[model samples]
Target: MDRKLNRELVKATALRSGYSFTKLAQEVSVSTESVSKWMSGETNPRPGKAIKLGKVLGLSYEQMFGVRDRTLEPQVAFRLVRNQDPSEEHHERAREMGRMYEDLVPFLPFNQFEAPPRLKSPTADYEYLDELCGSLRREMGLEADVPVSLPSIFNHLSDKLQAVVIPVFWGHRKNKAELAAHIYSRKTKTTWIPFNLDTKLWDARFWAAHELAHVYTFDVLDDEAGEIFSDAFAGTLVFPVPIARAAYEELAKVRLKTQKFNLIVEFAKRMHVSPICVAKQVDRYAVAKKQPPVNAEYDGIYAAISRMSKREKTVAEEFFGGEEPSVGQLLEAAANIFKSPFFDTLSKYLKTNGGSPSFIQGLLDCSLVDAKALNSELA
Candidate 1:
C-alpha cells in the first residue's frame, strides 16, 4: 500500500465506479474533506477510517498504505463472523462488515446445515421447503411486493420452520473486520442463537432480511440439485429480479471500483439485502450470466409459518428494538405464541456457549439418548 497506489486505487475506483468522495464520506459517516485528505495522503487514515476505505476501494490495509501491517486503532467496528462479544471499536467494525455483507455477500448461503441434495434424486425433500414457504406466504399474506425486514420474515416462519438466527465472527472478537449472522434450524424455535450485543442497527436489520430470504425463498425450488436455485430465490424474493437487474445494468458502467464493491453497494440498495449477500448474488448472477470471479454456492432458507412469525416479532420488539424485559415479561409470553426456542434458547445458549454448541440438548430442547433409552431400550 504505497502512497502512490493508495491514491491511485481510491481515485480510480471512485471515478470508474461513478462515486463521489461525498458518497465515500457518507459510507464511512465522515466528512468529504477527510476523504480528500486521505486521497492526498496528507494525513494517515485512522484505523476505523482505513478499513472503510479498504472496503470501498477493494484493497486491504497493507495494499492501501505503502506501509504493511498498519495498526488498526478504531474506537469501534462491526464485522462478520469474528468476535463473540464486540468492543465498541469492534462493534463499529461489525457494522461496517454488515454493510459489506448486506451490500455484497448478502445472498450467499449461511448454511449451518449440510449442502442441499442434487436434483432428480428420490432423496429430495421438497415437501419441507415447500410447506415452509407456503405456510409463510399464507401467514404473512405477503404479496410478491411485501417489504418485510428479514427478521420479521423469520418471525413469521419461526414456529413452523423450527429455527433461529445467530451472529458469528470468524477471527476477531467484535470488530467489523469479520463477523457474520447465521440462521439455525431446531426442533424448538426458542433454541436459536442471537446477534452480538454490539451489532449496529442497520446490520441487525439486514441480517433479519437475509435470514428471512432463507425462510421464504427456498420452499418451492430444488436446492439440492444445485444451490443456485435457493440462492437465486432468496435474492429474487428479497430484492426482486427486476430491481436487481436494473441496478446491475447501472453498476456495469462503472470501472473505478471492482465489480465486487460496485455490486455490493448497488444491489444492496436495490433489494435491501446485506452487502455480503449482494456480493454472493453478484457472483451467482455472474455465473448464471456466464461471467467469472464469482462463486455459485447456495444454502436453503425455508420454514413453517405459524411459529417463526411470532418468535421473530418478539425479537423485533425486544433485542433488535433494544428493550429489556423482566423475567415475567418473558414468562407471560406464551411458549407457542412466539417461535419455540428462539428467545429462551437464545438467551441460555448465548450466555453459555456463545453459539458453537456440540450437544443436541444444547442445540435443541430434545432428549437424545435418554428419551430413546426410557422408551424402548430400558434395562
Candidate 2:
C-alpha cells in the first residue's frame, strides 16, 4: 500500500513543525487512511512513499525505514573494514569485563566433543553475533568452571582478532550500556566485550566467554548474523559436545541413583560460568540428546553480570555513566578503556613491542590511559 513511518512519534513530530497526517499524506501522495495504517505498523511503507513521508515527518530514511541499527547502519557495515581500533575507554571498560573472562577460563568445562556444526567463513569478513547468551552456555562446555583473564587471555588474539571494548554508562545523558550490552562487528575474527556488567569475576568472564564464542561463530559460519549466532556459539563453547554428553550421562546416573549431583553448582565451580548457565547447558544437552530438559526445580539462575557489585567498583555497571559519553560507547570506549590515548598510539606501541605485552601492560605504555582505575583495581 503506502510507506511506514514512526507511528508513535508521528503526531508529535508532525505537530511540532505545524505538520499533520493529511500533510504527510499529501507529501507522499497517499490517502489519509493509508497513512494511518502505515503508522500503526499494519503495513510496510512503499519505498517511494516512505521516503516522502520521512521528509514530512522530519525523519531520516533509516528511521522511517525501521531497520535494526546494527543490521543495516552504514557504520556498522563499515566496522567490517577492521581498520579502526576499538576506543581505549571502551577497551578499559572491556578490561573490567575481561576480569570476568579471566576468572571463568580456569573452570571452563572443556567438552571438545559434541562436535559443533561447522560453517566456513564466506569471505575475509562477515558479521556474526546476536543477543542470546544462554545458547553460548551449552556450546562452550563452560560447566561453570571456566575463568577468563582479561589482561593475559586477550593478549593471545590481538593479531587475528579485532577486539572492541564498549563501556556502558548509566545516568550519563545517553545510555551506552544498552549499546554495549549488545554488539555488532564485521571482522568475525572477534569482538571482545572484555568487560561488561558487574556481578562477579565469573560473570564478567561469562560475557567475555560469550563474545569469545562469537569469534568462533565468525570463524566457522563465515557469515554475519551479529548476536543471533552468538548465542549458539556461546552455547557451544560452554556446553560443547563432550561435556554435554558427560553431563547428560551424569544426570542420567543421578536420576537412576536417586542422587544429587548439584550439577549446577558443581559446574559453576568447575567452569567459572554461572550456575544458571550450567542449568541451561544441562537443559540444552538433555533436549538435544532426546532427554527431558532440566527440571524446573533447578530453574533459578545466578546472574553472571552482577560481579561488578562484588568488587564495589562503579565502573562496569555504569553502562550509562561516564565522563565523556561518546568515548564510552563501544568502538570509542575500547580506545579509552585501557586508559590509552587512542588506538593509533596503542597500535604503535604494539608494533614497537611486537604486540606481545598483555592488554593492560600495553595500556600502560600508551598515553592518557587511566592506569590507576584500570590497573589491579579493575584488572
List the candidates' TM-scores in order.
Answer: 0.35, 0.42
- Model 2 / residue 313 / CA error / Å: 8.5
Question: What is the C-alpha lDDT profile of model 1 across 265-299, one tens digit per residue?
Answer: 54555454455555554454554456444331222
lDDT for model 1 comes to 0.42
Worst 10 residues of 2 by lDDT: 73-82
For model 1 the local lDDT of residue 43 reads 57
Give lDDT per model, in order.
Answer: 0.42, 0.43
Distance from true location, Cα of 38 in model 2, Å: 30
Q: Pick the candidate with the highest TM-score.
A: 2
lDDT per residue for candidate 2 within 1-379, as digits (tens), equals 1224567766677778786778777877888888777767776554445556766767876565455434321122112111244343333233333332332222223232333232354221111222132333334332333443443223322322344443323223332332223233331212334233332444444455445555545434433564445544554454445555566666665652224336545555666555555566666667655776545134223333234225433434443353433322533544433321234433444454444323543222221244333332332
